[model samples]
Target: MDVSLKNRFLKSYFSFSVGIWFSAIISFLSVPITSWLIEPAEYGKATMFSTIYSMILLIVLIGTPNGFMRLYHSVEEKRKLLWSSLVVPVFLSVIFFGFVLLFKDTVNIFLAGQKNSKAHLILVFAVFFGVLQTFSQTVLRMQEKGFSYSALQIVSAASNVLFVILYALLISRNFYAVLYAQLFSNILALSLGIYLHRESWFPIKIDKSLVKEILAYSYPFLLSGVVWWLFGWTDRIVLRMYSTFEEIGLYSAAFKLVSVMSLFTSGFSTFWYPFAYEQYEKNPNNKELFSKTFDYISFLILILALLIMSAKNVIFLLFAKSYRSSAYIAPFLLLQPVAITMAIVVARGIDFAKKTYWYIISDGVAAAFNIIGNLLLIPLLGAKGAAVTTGLSSIIVFAIEKAASEKLYPVKYNSKRAYVSMLILIIIASINTFFERFYVGILSSLTGIVVVTLLYNDVFRKLMKSFFEFLNRLKSMNK
Candidate 1:
């Protein structure tokens, strides 16, 4: 095994983490601004509309962007594949968006408590920008443009925070802040994506063969992404029907807050793809890379959830008490990051195995299970039920993916390391959350963070060394 490759992966991991850290920091800091100026009801509308828009995003984008990653320059017969990837989704989005617009009023009932008329208008731009952001980021990653991806995401996040601060704190009093911020962020990200496309120097030709492979790969992704959106975002819609708009607002706040943990996986996942592909291409049997990544990610996500959950009281004290009671949902929500990372691993493995359809099948089964679980659980359990349903489906889907992938690419996780660390962090969260004793919870959480740190310590040191060397090389090039 090449030590340098290991170091490179670690360095890449840190860079990815730093991006998420910045994004999360800005998000945490934005709370005070949001809570002070935007009323919970208004923010709730923002959340609801956004959630509806999220569902639309999956339908509009149609998963071609993700499929492009696997079918990029590496595949022979690239042109047809590229066209297949791009043309079909572009046409589908037009039809999808048209359907949305035609039934705007009925959809508005599902999407918003009060129709702004303008809200529907905003959705157009939001979905348009979202496709740009998604496609641009995908293209960047396929070319192994990690730094470009990171930079664009950072820029988008920063711009979003700035515009949101401007609107929420300075100018507007309503959900326009969300809309405006989203618009600006998407435009900025799309621009960066365009810039990186030029910089990456990849061929842009699209053709039939490329499209065939892309479609073949992306059909599973398209279905999976749509199902995931439904599974993930359905709570707000469900709550909207059964509960008050304000309740939906509270739930949205809680939901978005919990989603913060996803920064761990999202920030690194795109970047990890090329690294993993390179590793597999070079040394298919190097179990250490996958094992280490899993353990480190497991440790990383647990620590993230612990830190967020540990500081829940303080956060609630500052934001809204309505959300305080909802903190109980934190435990189930923490499972999401693990589930997402695991899902990514499993999905990738399945694709590697050439059983892409099995992925679609697995997710379809899981999605059905999730919807059924939600229908049964949500009326009684509320948002908590939705969280549990989402998580259970994720585990089920991941298990199926893992099993199916074994035939094509046999891989094993660091089971002992993952299990032990996972248990430790879960215990830590239980102590911190269940006990009323703040000092004990606080101390135990800190200790737990340290323990999690220890799990990734070797990787962390190697990362630091690699980073400094990377920086040094950059400095030399500049000179």
Candidate 2:
């Protein structure tokens, strides 16, 4: 990498990292606070409400945000592209809203189950704002406005904490309070997001040709998004069907704790797509660059997985007593993010090539397997089964995506290094989950550090070299 480009990348990276870390902390604090305030069953139901909005957002947007990001590279009129993406999705959302009203009774029964239909209705509005929130964030990212993007995230996270605290303490301490806080926070962020990207909203032109192009690029992505949702959320849904709300609560709590991995994945991911796509565009056949990037990402994820599993006890302490089973579930659930990180590394091929149908294939296969796995496993093993199934399903999806992507853009990743790191992680995680001893956790942490270091010594050396060089350059420039 050129020194100037590398420096700029690092600057953006640190900006994003700091912002995301702050956001993660707010989220981390909020989880326990929310868990503490509500009953386990209520918390579970609240989580389900969040999932309901996620499903609705997936349908309403139809992957247009993704196409918007990718197509921004080629589109001449950025505002027009934004208009097309927003207009079509908003139109679809309106139609979907009508359908919701028409089938209010049936939809309420299906989604709300024994809960109140009124909350689900509020979530419909939340879904609309949430879609806008996502679309606006994508525009910020595509424009490479990392600082603004991070600021928006900080505001969202802070507002979420504030609103949830207010509702829980002053107003109500029920699941509805949690949902309402989230809904209001999203609205706040959506409004701010629109203001930030206000340029994209105006002179609204419904460009039929642009909409057609965006849909063409995003069509496969739509299916992939649904399948990805299933891959991610089906476990909870199936578990809800087979188990009690307490179990769902436990699983959800554990999942939230393990999202420590997502802090890293998402923070880097915020910077990665734009960076990776730019790198690919600059030199399409730079196979080694992609390969080395994948290796580094894989190593980082493994290290994070190890640390989180080792510190499960510390994480569990933050939760209420009723949610403590989340500690044991955390180790297995941590693997899900590792798999996701790996998938992100390899999925770039399909993304860059615009062969997003491969994403559908990979996500679909794993989602189907996960649903079946959950049905079988949740009946026998309960939450643990769901966690294990989620991990394995993600791993399978990563493998399939990597295999498919390599055929299209043959990045020569160090497969042995990645595979071995993953295998060691699996062994260490299994030990931590099953053995459940402080010594085992300690030993596994040490082993993970040593093994990963030995496996990626070259990468580490280069990373250190780059760091020192960067520091020296900074000092010289100051002088």
Candidate 3:
């Protein structure tokens, strides 16, 4: 890459990454505060509500955002393209809402109490705004306006936090309040997003050919999303079914803590498709580039896992004493993102080859494993069982996806180094889980850190060298 292009990528990466990092911090802060304010059972119920909402949102979206991003750069009538993307999701969402109405009693069973009718209605709005926010943010990204995209993201996150705090203070801190906060925050963000991109909403003509193309690209994501959602949330749903809400609450809290890993993964996710597609378009022969990129990203995520796992105790201290037991699963849960990152990096192979059916198959198998694993384990072991099984399922999915992707579109990834790092992580995590001694956990963490550093010394040096070189340039410019 040329210096200018490399610098632009780095700048855009950090610009957007800082927004995700800030959002993660805000989200992390909300958990302990919300947990403290609400009853454990209520917190669990609210979390259950959010989980269901996420699943529905995924279904309603039908992976259109990914389709939109993929097609955005190529299409001439971006406005029509954007509006066309919205039509199917909006139509599907309405149909889903109708079904929710038809099955009012069934939906309320999960929600239980506190204005059940109102909560369901607000949930529909949340899903609507959620889809809108996703498209608007993606549009900004498609335009390469990283700073604006980051601004809106930070605003949405900040507004959510602020709303939660206000709701807890002004109203009740129960599930109702949580739902109300979510509804208002989504509305606020969506309104701002629409205002920012109001011009694009015009000339709303449906291009049949473009719509077909987007659907062709998005269909696999639609299928894979459903399977992926099941894989991600079956543990919680099963816990709700077989176990108690309190256990669910504890598990949910651990998930919130582990979500900090998204601060890193989220940034990469935003950059990856656009970056990957751009690189492939420029040079399809850049196999080594993709492979090295995967190794480097996997290692970075491992570093994040190491940092979070090592500080698991300190991090959990922010939770209520009743909720602190949630910390035990943090080590396992922290690795979830690592597994996800590996799959995402390697999946580039399948994406370039346009064989998204592999994703559907991979995720379907993994979701089944997760469901079966949760069933067998939750009854026997509780939250810890859920954690162990979930981690194992994630790794299974990654392995399957990587194997399939490599076979289809070979990328000469540094498999040995990557596998070694993963092995070390698994061992150290197991040690920490079993021993629970402060020194043992710390020692295991140090060992993992050492292994990662040894494997990634070159990447580390290059990063540091870039930092110093940038600083030197800044100094010269100021002088």
What count of clashes does model 1 give? 11
Shift of residue 34 alpha carbon in model 3, Å? 4.1
**Which digits, one per residue and each the tens of the lDDT, describe model 2 over residues 1-479?**
56686677778777677778888888867776877787877776787778788888888888888788787777778888888888778888788778878777776666556534676577678877887888878877777788888888888889887887788889778777778878887888778878867887777766889999888888888898888876777887888899998888898888876777888888788877877776787788877767777877787788778877777877788777888767777777887889888788788888777888988898889988898999999999889889888888888888999998888888777887887887887787777767767787778877887899889998788878988987999999999
lDDT of 1 by residue, 16-125 (tens): 56666776777777777777777887887888887777877777666677676665546654444445566776676677668768877866665565544567767777
TM-score-based ranking, best first?
3, 2, 1
> Measured by TM-score, how close is model 1 to the native structure?
0.78
Estimate TM-scores for all models: 0.78, 0.89, 0.89
Each candidate: what lDDT? 0.68, 0.80, 0.80
Query: Global lDDT for candidate 2?
Result: 0.80
Better of 1 and 2 by lDDT: 2
Clashing pairs in 3: none
For every model in order, what is the number of clashing pairs? 11, 0, 0
Model 1: worst 10 consecutive residues (lDDT sum): 196-205
Instruction: Give the candidates in order of lDDT, highest first.
Output: 2, 3, 1
Lowest lDDT 10-mer window, candidate 2? Answer: 111-120
